[model samples]
Target: MARDPYRLIGRIQQVAHSLRKKSDHLLIDSAGVTTAQAGILSVIAGDPGCSQRDIARRLRLGESAVVAAIGRLRGAGLVERRVSDQDPRAVALFLTARGRETIGRAQETYGVLNGLVLDALGVGGRARFAELLDALDSAVASFPDRPDEAGPPGPD
Candidate 1:
């Protein structure tokens, strides 16, 4: 018998929601930031001088959402924006000293969460699970109506 695909989708959503809730709590307690904010910070931390468009694209978020997050981060002195050298019309994002510190704490929190997930999956299972997730993502990307259909999904 064919398995119900919707059941798998629902399970995926449930697991994601649970993990997001836990991550939000850990992030709030560790860095006084929301998971969304932490995600933007982490991306900026990894790619200094990246544009807001870059962040939005990489995070699969809307431009306005990324703009708002950047506004909050700037207000909190966790992020700084500078004129982009590549595009004068665009702005580049950088993590401030405090932002780096906050990101360090956020990384620790994520590490704990990662450990929990890996422990649950076991060492060998972790690798296989990651492969499965990648395959799923690729399959979804292959759908004809996908917005960004230029090519297949790249490695995470």
Candidate 2:
């Protein structure tokens, strides 16, 4: 069968959008947080003193995007920022009592979505999908360094 990259890309986009909408409904309703906020909070829950840079790296998000998310989360009273005693210039993130409770409310979304993936893909397929995703990540990471192939499309 001929491979169509666009099909794969579109499928990924659709699945991501669907998952976001479903999770957003439950999370925003219960915790007053979106999936993005829950994700940032999860990182903080796992690593209490992590910096925004750490969250950005872990989430594969740009630093500026993480900063904005953090700002919103801070404003919502869901997260706290403290000047790191170890590094005066760096700010560390920690979840507040409210943040912890909020994440607790949203944790079910992760488990439910993960279970859906497992059921849809099966264990073997899940492993293969992980390998495929890692390969794609490597390809994308080096793509900018590679020379363009045939340049941009021209009039047919």
Candidate 3:
């Protein structure tokens, strides 16, 4: 009998959860940065001068949550905000020197975890996993935008 797709998906998600937990623990142990902080830093590193709104959208997080996270990062001297050149009313975000160094360390920690995960998959399995992950991502991206798309789903 064929396996249920939903069951398989649930198993995959459980595996992901386990891996993420381990990764978060490793980050805290090695870099002293929380997973959430590291993720925000990575996003800022990729898109310097991004608006808080854009950051929230990309991370699928609440605008207020993003703001709070940014505030924390700013307080830590890891991020800076300035008025957007294109929109005077909008604030743009970027990493400070300290933030850049922290992000670099975070990336190294992530790289190690990634390498371990990939190695555990072996060559063929890794390639297939990447292909499937990409296909799923593309499929989700192609879906039509919903009314609540501007913000993340409401809290359950």
Candidate number achieving the greatest lDDT relative to the actual structure: 1
Error of 1 at 54 (Å): 0.4
Model 1: residues with Cα > 4 Å off, grouped in runs: 1-5, 146-156
* Number of clashing residue pairs, candidate 1: 0
Between 2 and 3, whose lDDT is larger?
2
lDDT of 3 by residue, 60-145 (tens): 88999999989999999999999999989988899999999989989999999889988999988998988999998898788887
Ten contiguous residues minimizing lDDT sum, candidate 1: 143-152
For model 1, how big is the CA root-mean-square deviation?
A: 7.2
Candidate 2 vs candidate 3: the TM-score winner is 2
By summed lDDT, which 10 consecutive residues of candidate 3 come out lowest? Answer: 145-154
Question: Which candidate, 1 or 3, has the higher lDDT?
Answer: 1
Q: Which candidate should be chosen as best, given TM-score against the real structure? A: 1
For candidate 1, what is the lDDT?
A: 0.93
Q: List the residue pairs that clash in candidate 2.
A: none
lDDT of 2 at 50: 95
The residue-level lDDT of candidate 3 at 99 comes to 93
Q: Rate the local accuracy (lDDT) of all candidates.
A: 0.93, 0.89, 0.88
1-156: candidate 2 lDDT, tens digit per residue:
886876987888888899889989877888789888899999999999899999999998899999999999999998999998789998999999999998988897677778988899997899999899899889888778656788888999
State the TM-score for model 2: 0.82
